[model samples]
Target chain A: MQLTGGQMVCESLIREGVEVIFGIPGGAILPLYQTLPEYPKLRHILTRHEQGASHAADGYARATGRPGVAFATSGPGATNLVTGITTAFMDSVPMVIVTGQVGRSAIGSDAFQETDITGITLPITKHNYLVMTAEEIPAVINEAFHIASTGRPGPVLVDIPKDVFEEMGEFEYPEKMDLPGYKPTVHGHPNQIRKAAKLIEESERPVILAGHGVIISKAYDELMELAEKAQIPVVTTFLGIGSFPDDHFLSVGMPGMHGAAYASLAIDQADLLIALGMRFDDRITGDTSKFAVNSKKIHIDIDPSEIGKNIPVDVPIVGDLKLVLKVLNERVKPTTRVDWVQHVEDLKRDHPLMHERDTDELLPQHIIQQLSELTDGRAIIVTGVGQHQMWAAQHYTFKEQCSLISSGGAGTMGFEVPAAMGAQVGRPDKVVWSIAGDGGFQMTMSELATLAENKIPVKFAIMNNGFLGMVRQWQQIFYEKSYVATGYSRNPDFVKLADAFGIYGARVTEKSQVKSAILKAMEHDGPALIDFVVEQEENVYPMIPSATSVASMIEEPKPEEIRQ
Target chain B: MTTTESPKHTITALVEDKPGVLNRVSSMFRRRGYNIASLAVGHSEIANLSRMTFVVEGDESTVEQVTKNLHKLVDVIKVSDVSIQNCVSRELALVRVRANVQTRSEIMQIVDIFRANIVDVAPDSLMIEVTGDEDKVDSLQNLLRSFGVLEVMRTGTIAMDRGLGDEQTDKDNSSSTHRMESGL
Candidate 1:
C-alpha cells in the first residue's frame, strides 16, 4: 500500500513493535506528527524538552532490551537529542532515533531549522541512515533496529528529510537485513577457548570478573555455572551489579574505584583471571600494571577489537558472551580447590564491606538499604552518579544482572530517572525504582511528563542532599570543605513538580518518614517521586582515593578530625 | 626442540576463493591473536571470490593462532602453514627502468639471468616485469639499481602450496575436527 513518508514512519514503527514514542513536535517533524493519531496503538509522549524525550526513549530501551524510539524535528530538536544519544552510546544501549530534517535541497544551503544531525552524531552512534524516499524508510528502520540491538549493541539514528516524508511510496519491510560488510562474530575460536580452560585448570587461584556484557548477552546462568564449576570467586565491575546474585557464595560483589577493598585485594592476588563480558575501564583497573599482577588473564568478549585493546590477554575469545560462556562451561571441570576459595573468604572477613552512619539524621545509605528491604529484591533500582550513586552501590545488594542499570563509565548525572524510564519499559510487571541525589534528579526532571504520558509506575527516590554530593565530598576531603557551585539554595518542591506533570509525589524531612514515603510511592498506581531531605554532609567511605603513588591510600579522616 | 635460540617467523598466503571463506580459514589458526600481517585481496584464478594472501608474524604461539583461526572462516577452502611447510613463496614486481645506451646492456644481461621480461621498450625507458621468490625479487631489483629505476608497482605476496593439484578438498579439513585434533 502507498502511503506518505510520515505515515510510513508511524506504520513502520508499529511493524517494528514500537508502541511508545517520546518526542516533542516541531516544524521539521510535522509530517510525522500528522499520522500519529491514526495509529491508535502508537502512543506519542509530548515532552517538555527534546532532551527529555530522547532520555525517555533511552530509559525505555535500557529497561527492556528492546530498541527505544525517540522523535524530534530538525535543527534544535536534533541537537537536543545529542546528550541522550551520547549517553546511550557510552552505556551501549540500543535505540532507534527518528528525527525530521529540512528537504534535501536545503541541507547544504543552511536553511532555517536545518542542522547536520547525522554529521553531529557521527562519533556517538553505531551507524546512521538518511531516508531519501518512503520505500527506504521501512527497510532503513528495520536495519536500524537490527544493527542497534545486535553485535556490540549501540544506538543507531535514522534522519528523514521533510520532503521525503511528504512524498508517497509503496511500504515494504524486509524480514532480514543483508549487509555484506557488517558480519558480527558469534562463536568463539576453538583454540582460544581451550587455552582459557587449560589456564584455569592450572591456576591455584582463579577469579571470574563479570561485567555488563553478561547482562547484555543474557549469560548470567553461564556465568554462575563457570564460577561454580571452576571453584572460583566472582567479582563485578561497577556497572556489572546484579550480574550474579549477591547472595551467591562465590560472588564477591562490585570491585573498582568505589568497589569493596577486599574485592580489589582478591583481584590483586589471583593467579588466573577469567574476565567475562566486562571491559577493563581505567576506573575498574586503577593501575593497569599493578592490576592482577600475579595473574594470566583470559579475556572473553563479543567485540573483537576490545580483546587486546586494553590489557594484554594470554587467551582472548571473541564471541557472544552467552555462547562463549556455554563453551567454557562445558570445557571446565568441576574441581574443588578448597584452599583458594578459603583464601578469598578470609580476605572477605578481614576487610568486611559495611556502612556505618554515626549520626541522628537520616543518612542516604539508610534510605537505600530501606528501599532494598521494602522492595525485597523485586524492584529494579537505577541511580545517577555521585556520592549517592556510590553509596547505593556500596549499600544496596542487587539480586540480578541489569537490575541496577546506572551510568558507570560516562557517569552521566541525569541517568537514573530516564534509565528508570527505560527499565520500566523493559519490565512493566515489576516495581522500577529510580534512586537519585538532589543534583542528579534535577538534571533530567523534565522526563516526568514521559512517565505521566505513558502511565509507567516508576517510583523516584530522590535523596535530597542539596548539593552535588560527590564533588562536595571531594571538596571536604581535599580542599578543606571550601564548597563551590556544588551548593544550591532551597530548590523547588519535587512533589509539586511531579504534581504539575499530573503524577503523584511526596516529601519526607525526618528519618521516621523516609520508609513510609517510599512505601506510599510504591503503592501508588502511577508514576511517583519521593523527595527525601537526606543529610547533606554524609560521604561515601572506604574510597580508594585516586592516588599519585600506588602504594599509599589517603583514607577519609574521622568526622571529628575534619571539624578542626 | 633443545635449541637455546630459535626465532619464529610467519608465512604469507594468497588464495583464490569465495566469501565466508575467511572465517573458515582463520579458524584454522589456533590463537585468536594471530595477527594478519598484511592481507591484500584482488582478482585471481576465479572471478566470483578472488585471491587473498595474508602475512602473519609471530613466535611459535602466533603460528598456532593463525592456523586455528584460518579454519573458522566458512569460505576458506584450504590453509597452508607455508612458513614451515616446503613451499615456493614468490612475489611479482613491475619496474619502470631508466634505459639509456650507456647502462641498458648491463641491465638487460642481469635481467636475463633473473628471468625478467622487458614488457615495454621506449627510447629512454624500459619497463620490466619480474616474478620470483623473496630472494630472486630482491636480487633482481638490486641489479637494476645501476640502471636508475624510476617507478615500481609491486603486488603484495600471494602464495600457493609448493606442489599443488586437486589432492585436498575443502571438506577434508573440517574446522571442528581440525580444532579437536589440535587439542585447542
Candidate 2:
C-alpha cells in the first residue's frame, strides 16, 4: 500500500500490538502528530517532558510485560530520553524509542535542534538505527520491536528524519526477523539440569536467589514447584521483590544493603545456592569475595554473559528460567529441610523487619504498610529512589506478580509520578500507588498535570521528610552529622499543589490520620495525593556499608533510644 | 599461570560491512578496559561481510569475556579464539633505517640473510619489508636497531587455522607455542 513514512510508522506500531504511547510533540516530529488523528486505535499520552515519557513507557512495560512505545523530537528531546533509556538499560526493560531527526540534508550540518542521538546512545541501547529512506520504515520498526522485546530485552532507538517521515513509501511489514547473532539460549542442557538436581537433592542447606528474570519469564509457578519440592528458601533481589510471594512460608525476603538482616545471614550460611536469573549486582552482594562463602552456587539465566559476570558459580546453566525450572522440577526429588528451615525461621523471628517510631510522629514505614494493608497487598506500587523507596520495599507485602515497580539499578530520583501513570495506564483495572519522598517527588511533580489530564487513577503518597533522606542518612553516619546541602528547610505545600493540578488532595500530620488518608485516596474515583509529614531524620537500618561484609551489618537502634 | 606473566589472545570476528560496527566493537573494548595490542580489518570472501583480527592482552577469564562480549554485538556473526590453537599467522613490517655511505651494503647483506626485501631507498635511508610471525618481525627490527632505526610500521597479526575447509575447528593439540610468541 502507498503511504507516507508517518503512516507507515503508525501502521507498524499497530501491527506490533502497541495500543498506547507516551511522548510530546516537537517541530521535527510534527508529521507523526499530523498523522495521529487518522489512527484512532493509538493512544498518545502527552507527557510534560521527554524523560517522563520514557520512564512512563518503562513503567508500562514492567506492568504489562509488553514492549512499551515512546516518541520524541530531535536534539534536546532526544537527549532528555538518555536518563530514562539508561534506567531501562540498567533494569533491562523493553522499550522502542522513536526520535525525529532534522532533514536528511542537514544531518551532519548541526542544523537547528539537530542531535546525533544514535551516536550518543550507542552503548546504552540494545541496538539503534538511523533511517535514511522511507521505504525501510516498516521493516525498521518491525526489527526494532523484535530486538527490543526478545532475548534479555532493552530499549532500541529508531531515529527517523523529518524528510523520511514526510516522504512517500510502499509499506511492507516482515513477518519474521533473521538475526543470527541475536539468537538467545532458551533451554538448558539436560546433563546440567541433572547435575543441578543431584546437587539439590544432596545438599542439606539450599537457598534460592530469585531476580527479575523470574518475573519477566513468568516462572512463578515453576519456581514455587521447584522450591517446594526441594524445600529451599527463596531470597529475592531488590528488583525481584514481587517475583516470589513475600508471605510464602519459604520466602526469606530481600538481602543486601538496607535489606532484611536475616535474609543476608541466610545467604551467608547456606551450603548450596540456586541462583535464578539474577546478576549478583554489587549492591546485592556486599563483598563479592565473602558473599555466600559457604555456598556452592548454580546460576541459571537466559543471558550467558550474566552467569559469571560478578560471582563465579559451580554450575552455570544458560536458559530461560521457566523452562529450566520446569525440566528441573521433574528430576528433582522431594526433600525435608526441617532443621535448616527452622534455623532460618528462628533467624527471621529474631531479626523481624519492623518500623521503629518512639514518639507519635508519623513514619514513612507506617504509611507504606497501611497502603499495603488497605489494598490487601495487591496494589501495584511504583517508587522513586531514596529513603521512601527502601521503606516501600521493606514495609510493603507483595502478594501478586509484578506488584512492585521501582528504578532499582539506576536509582533514578524522579521516577515515581510518571511511572505510576504508565503503570495505571498499562493495567487500568488494577490499583497503583505512587510513593516518593519530598526530595524525589519534586523532581517530576509537573507530571501531576499529565495525570489530571488523563484521569489516570494512581494514588500518590509523598513521604514529606523535608530532606534528601538517603543522603542525609549517609551524612549522619559517615560525615559526622555534617548535613551539607542535603537538608531542605522549606518546601511547597504538596496538598495545595495537587489541588492546583485538579486532583484530590489531603494532608496527614497525626498518626491517626494516616490510615484514613490512604483510605480516602483509594476511595477517590481519580488520581489523588496525600502529603505525609514524616520524621525528618529516620534512617533505613539493618544497613550493610558499601563493600562491607554481611558480618558488619549495622542494626537499628531501639525505638526509645533513637529519638523523640 | 605465573602471576608475573601476562597472557595474550588472538581473536577473529565476522561482522556486517556497515557503518559504526567498528566503533561499536572498539567502544565495547574501551569501556570494558580490554587492552588491544594490534587490530586489522578487511573485506572477506563473502560479499557484505568483513573480517577483523585483534590481538589483545588478558588473562584466561578476560579472554573468555572478550570473546563472549564480542559475540553480543548484533553485527558480529562469528568469533574464534585462535590464541593457542594450531593456526598459521603472519605479520608484516616496513623498517626505515639510517643507511648512508658504507652501512648500506651491511644493511643489504643482513636483509639478504633474513630474506627481507628493500621496498624503497632514499639517499640516507633504506626501507626494508619483512613478513613472518610476530617473533620474526620483532627479530628483524631488533637486528636493525643498532643501525639507528628511523621508523617502523607493523601490520598486526592475522591468522587462519590449519586444514581449513571450515572457518572454525574443534581440534586441539594443547601446545604452548603462543607463550613463545605472545611476548611484548
Clashes of 2: 0
Candidate 2's residue-wise lDDT over A233-347, tens digit each? Answer: 9999989999999999999999999999999999999999999988999888988998999999999998888878889889999998999999999999998899999999999
Residue-level lDDT of model 1, residues A252-285, one tens digit each, is 9777677777788788888988898888887777
The lDDT of each candidate is 0.77, 0.90
Listed for each candidate, the true contacts retained, as a fraction, are 0.00, 0.64
Which structure among the candidates has the greatest lDDT?
A: 2
Q: Model 2, DockQ value?
A: 0.70
RMSD (Å) of each candidate, 1 decimal: 7.7, 2.5
- Candidate 2 achieves a global lDDT of 0.90
Segments of candidate 1 deviating more than 4 angstroms: A547-564, B1-184
